[model samples]
Target: MITSISTQIQLAARPVGWPRPNDFATVQIELGELAPGQIRVVNEFISVDPYMRGRMSAAKSYSAPFGLGETMTGGAIGRVVESASDAFPVGSVVLHQFGWRDVVQEDAAGFKVVPEIPGAPLSLYLGILGMTGLTGYVGLTAVANMVPGDTVFISGAAGAVGTAAGQIARLLGAGRVIGSAGTDEKVALLTEKYGYDAAFNYKSGPVREQLAAAAPEGIDVFFDNVGGEHLEAALDVFNPGGRAALCGAIAGYNSTERKVGPDNMVNMITRGLSLKGFTLGSYLDLAPEFNEHMTAWFTAGKIAYDETVVDGIGNAVDALLSMMQGANTGKMVVRTAVMADVIR
Candidate 1:
């Protein structure tokens, strides 16, 4: 037996406005023995995202919703400890969708083998060089059609994808990068650390006012995360022929009730604005290209990334909940020592 210590977070109840203790259950599971074509992955870190909240609900959407009394699913990074296939070795690092579990046994077909980096941290592959980075790249380049000399604005500016979006836009020769974040601290980090030209706190007042103050002339590209009011606000201040990349709406994820369409959506027609929503899964083809650009940016120190890593895989549930609530400063991740414990 591998004796892997697997901590699984399960759905206890469907939450309404916020995920309470009743909505989550952290339990231990015994990982099954490895077999041919199967690899035993000792999970190291897991990503906590706002979109997972939509999956927890029974509502119809693109992805299948998470069922009641089942293990909550999300993305994670792991190491191969025992492999049954010739293609996979015992020490290969990989990224997979195994949720919050500390250990997993799976076939080698679906996993992305992480390449080794000489000067960078391995955990960075889970952030800047990973899916979130690709999401930002594709959303900015393909979805928003961002161009040089275009002024850009981003919502949820302090979070994972937003950080990458702003920096990537700068790398693309954006004229100005403006962002809105939940707290003053995050707003400061956007302008101070991430090279955003202007940043404001959306929580302080109406998003429209904050954005107007940040980009007085008008925004050319809007990378939206907190939809609803922020979407409405973006529509109001966007220039003619402006582009809006609709990413996750972390603002409305906790609400069980349906939100009314933004009142300012009509402005899209009048102003000739384009609002395009896309998930990272929609642009898988660009992953390799994104990695090349991102690695170069990181090497040149032209782009910097941030992350908020919570200790212990057991805290994955809480970390995910916190991420949805805007508690994390950057990419929210849960780190685990379960592989070491299992090897011991």
Candidate 2:
């Protein structure tokens, strides 16, 4: 008698530029009887990332693209209701790949048991303490080779990865952290709240000039999220032997095709620059280190974050595309209806 109403969003059409509402469809589904070793979870919040827009189209990327008519792929954290196995009991929380769904019944082994954080908010798992945090940590520590006293620059400073990167760099003893965001509000938050020494709104002027002003002596490390112009600009401002942790090329996701690579490739030779493309999935082994650092930072009140949450599972498509359109102020999460009414 445990019936679950699941709201599922599927890719209806490939987007040409910006994704229209019609490009996705939200459908309500009925759950069947669960088999042994199966667990049904009521999804609380799902992530909406800039990288997901690429999955909507049939283009080659780090992860497989979503089929023309398939459920959008992402991450979600949920609460288990009816469990057919003892390993996961009712009332336990879990994390799984149940993206854009209200409730899901998957194999018990498919999910990871989330440790309790009674004082901290659950939404932290979808942001600072989750995969997004790990992405920034691994990129900075491993790929960027960041060290204490190094000057850092971050593109897309308002988004999840960018925000986390700036804070982590400061905590690791960076001398300065400069960032670029889309809006004046985000730029202000970067400097005032998130501990960035300097930040600017990329929409206001050329990225190169803005970065040069923020980092007059040049930056030792650049954590790139908004690619294209941001990437091009980083090349001009990187200190000799500086490293670039290329986390995402979000600015070019909506473009028709490849528009421009950095014109300052010559800087790579003269300055001994290194730009590396990285994904969080490739550095799962470093998750323990990231979680340890982030947990302590959160507990000690050293880290800060923001979230732009949209209510209702039906509006998931809008929330998902908003990350690409720069409509989101911080981490974007599609909040399902089960929360607040039942918890708060």
Candidate 3:
């Protein structure tokens, strides 16, 4: 029998506006033994996302708030180290919502075993091949109803979902794909690497002006990640009968004051545009479809992705804050020290 000490991060205080490092606390617990039907895992990658900021708040949302003084939960991938269940033996890779911990000991039912793809990093399961990728696929195909030759626009285009959205749009036979990022370097990456037809740095000029210059013919589909000015810009440039998928409102995630909506909302009535807001929970039924397409695209070498990894469980809160501030190029994840010993 092997005993292990798991270092876990707990939410100490609910945050107001931007979360501070003091809002979280790190604690260690000894895993003395595994009970019946239990499995122990050493986490490799833990996901940090924009949606998590919403969970930190006490307000009502699509998901329940994280309990104060409890270990936080989100997407994580790891390999089983010990197991009492035959279904999940030692050495099996698994994905779960155990989150922010270097190791986890839980019932086997709480984790799902996933295959290890040869030559691919297991961390990919937390990003391009996982929920992040699925979000982009569903937002474009189902929510926005993007079709062949439809001109598409994506805000926050250098981030995980945004990068995936741009490439997915091109593969879906979009006539043109435009994107907006926070920096000039990201704008270049979008055009050179992610297959975006045009990209602009949102900080350079007004979003509406940049978008209008990029898409002179007007956009038919809008995959919105940043709201506020970006949404207003989309509304200003949308062609008649345009459709939009409201995937996230990252722009105002940390705003202490109530955010004002897009001023050009009346364009929806005048131009007969359709805007639908969605949370991934309601659309999880499309996972199979998403997996099929994403797997094929990835296998065929049509997908490109990036990950900004923060090393150690202690830095998880810092990683999340950096992602919200547009510091990460793609999906931002935390890599535990245990992951360093295992390359694959």
Candidate 4:
């Protein structure tokens, strides 16, 4: 007789700073019959993001910490192989938050049905057409209140959000787009691929100097991803009435010591600058609006997205580590199924 089983990665230990291989454990569980409203999904792709690092810690945050010994969760795109609900029948494609597993058995209420895009990979739901793309849109439109002809500056310019933000800023009528990345190669891609007007390697010189050189006219908007020194640098050169959407602080995610706040915070008062930190949850109400624009841009071939794919659910832990270390060029994803398993 055949049996049903699922493979999942569970948090075994909390990290003091950077996560380690020992922090996670992969286990196989025998699957049980689905309840009346539940479904069985086989994940095609799963996302590994910077925000997941914060979830690993036990500290109180905007989102709940991942429970110890429980399977880790994030965004995933999968096909419903079995379903007990009329809402989602067999062969349906769905998006859900029950990731880090090769297979998931969950209630239909948590899963959302997504329309299949022709000639598009399901992984796009975890990147450009997903939260990563929405972050850029929200930061530019709602948080920073971007206006046409505003000069925009972005830190961590080659990561998923940064790359999307640069292009989105252009589409919104930015006069100039400047970005800073860790490596020279990423810096080149920021301008050549992402349409940034000026791109610099943060490692090449002091951030303050590099940013000033890149944006001599001063920036009207700042989309921050890597905080710490980058935040201070933005503050130093912001024009009067400048606005910033403070998104992530990857610079301090793994620090054992407390990271210091920007030294030039007084600029906010003097320059009338507005800096707002946001989580995707607070801006989720804009999803319908964002999806409409993103879909249009994608269909018109105006928007471009890149994915750094690591094969197999077994390497999910390694993929997360690599992403944290900036090993990937764009959105980092783990492929749970082989090509033959994916219908789309």
Candidate 5:
């Protein structure tokens, strides 16, 4: 029988810098009777992303800040177990944005029905087939305007969007692909698993020197996931007419002090480089194009990806912190319950 309560992780307090356990509170709420056009869903998988950190801050950003004492929201995929809406039937698989909870009751409009593929897991909706993959495709194709034969460099190349960016760059016909990771293992995975032509551990040496050695001829495109030093290095090696997609700056997300930017501002003018920072919210119009290409690529076995899964809703906060600390290989997802049990 379906439970009559919902468990949620709420924001208890905003972090000063790095988030702490006391910053969140786990609470349970009594489930109310479903209203017309509403559905009850049991989340199967929840996504933990770096972007959420920015939302935790009270300062304004592209998205609004999460209200303290309220349930934190993010991407989640669930199975509708009870429904009062004709559009969403019981047993329907759906994806929604009401997350940080194990079960949710919301208007059906909050949910979107997802196709049930025979072999693929629903978790794909939160990763490669989802927004993360779209972010990568958008960065390379639209933001950077990459063309065939361009040499591309990606920072934070082992994480979700980074891994996707590396594969998407190659798929988009980049002549050479290079990546920067925090660890040697991650660097190795970039070259071996993600098909990066060359990869370096930023911790091993200065990024500019390592990148210069990797691509002696210089890069035509850069996908900046880790800003600060990575951005500085990218600026140093960009060829004339190079383009860059400034995706995120995980390096400074939790800093209590002001983070210094790259020192090479003159490179932009001298190299005639174009750099643009983008948020995925502005590019939903490209969803059809992203889905069409990524689906075909995944179906054809041309793209490679990974996920670091943390089990249980109770561990969601830890999963988020682990991901921010670079413990995750690709997408960091939380599996709420046994997949078969939830579906059956």
Candidate 6:
């Protein structure tokens, strides 16, 4: 009989503005022997995303709020150590929604086995090879209808999805790619490493002026991650018949007060621009197509990504908070002790 203990983080209380450490409670629970058709997994890496901030709040949204006192759930990839099911044998790598926990034992149906990609860390499954990459790909192709030779601009370009969006935009044949980051260092990284034609630090000056200076001829496509000022800037600089994919509004995620809408409301009507807001759930039908294209590009050495890894499940809350504050340059993930010696 295999008995184990799992360290899990739970939502203790709904956050008001920004989440505090007190809002999350880390606890340990012992597990009994696995039942028939059940599997036990030790997590390697867990994802911490900006969208999760919304889930912490009690307000109604696209995804249901995380129940108080329950384990925080998101994306997690791990290896099965023991299993009673034939489908998930011992040592199979799997991905599941049982997140923020170092160990999990659940029915086999809740987990999906995935093959290990040679030379790439399994953590990539939590980032570029997973939802983060798919979001960027779908936003550009399906939602924004980005065509070749379009001048593309991505806000919050140093973050995980933003970095992926910038690189994917270039590969999609955009004539020019511009990005905005919080700091000058991130801005430099965007143009130098991510193939962004131009990049600007949004904190340096007014977003409208900086964006205009970057795209003097005007932009045809906007992949917006930061709303408020960034959205306003994109609208002001968009060419006639331009398009936008409203991916996120992290700027207002922690606000205690209501955020004002963009002042440039008439630009949409006068410029004949098209804007669409989307959640990944509505566009998951495109996953097969995204995997094909992304796999080919990544395997061919065309894709470049960065990850900011924090060492332990206990610090998951800190990692999430830092990421939301733009302290991370790329994907922010929490690594567990079980991750050791797994990836070559």
Q: How accurate is candidate 5 locally (lDDT)?
A: 0.92
Candidate 4's residue-wise lDDT over 71-148, tens digit each? 999999888888999999988889999989888898999999987556567888888788999999999999999999
Model 5 TM-score, all chains together: 0.97
The sequence of per-residue lDDT tens digits that candidate 5 reaches over residues 1-344 is 35568889999999999999999999999999999999999999999999999999999899999999999999999988889999999989999999899899999999999865446778888987899999999999999999999999999999999999999999989999999999999999999999999999998999889999998999999999888898998898999999999999999999989898888889999989999999999999999899889878888888787889999999999999989889999999999865457566
lDDT-better candidate, 3 vs 6: 6
Worst 10 residues of 3 by lDDT: 335-344
Model 2 Cα lDDT, one tens digit per residue, 224-243? 99889998898998899999
lDDT of each candidate versus the true structure: 0.84, 0.86, 0.91, 0.90, 0.92, 0.92
| Model 3 Cα lDDT, one tens digit per residue, 311-340 | 989999999999999999989999996665
| lDDT for predicted candidate 6 compared with the true structure | 0.92
lDDT by residue for model 1 (1-344), tens = 24465668888887877878788888887767777799888888888888888887788987998878888877888888889887779888888887777777878886778876667766667777787888889999999999999999999989989998999999999998999998999998998999999998988998878788878889999998888888888888899999999998887787768887788778888989898999887788998889889878887878787889888876777788788879988788888765556543
> Per-residue lDDT for 1-344 in model 6, tens only?
12388999999999999999999999989999999999999898999998899999888899999999999999999988889999998889999999999999999999988756666788988888889999999999999999999999999999999999998888989999999999999999998899999999999999999999999999999999999999999999999999999999999999999899999979999999999999899999998898888888988999999999999999999999999999999899999865565432
Number of clashes recorded per candidate:
1, 0, 0, 0, 0, 0
Clashing pairs in 6: none
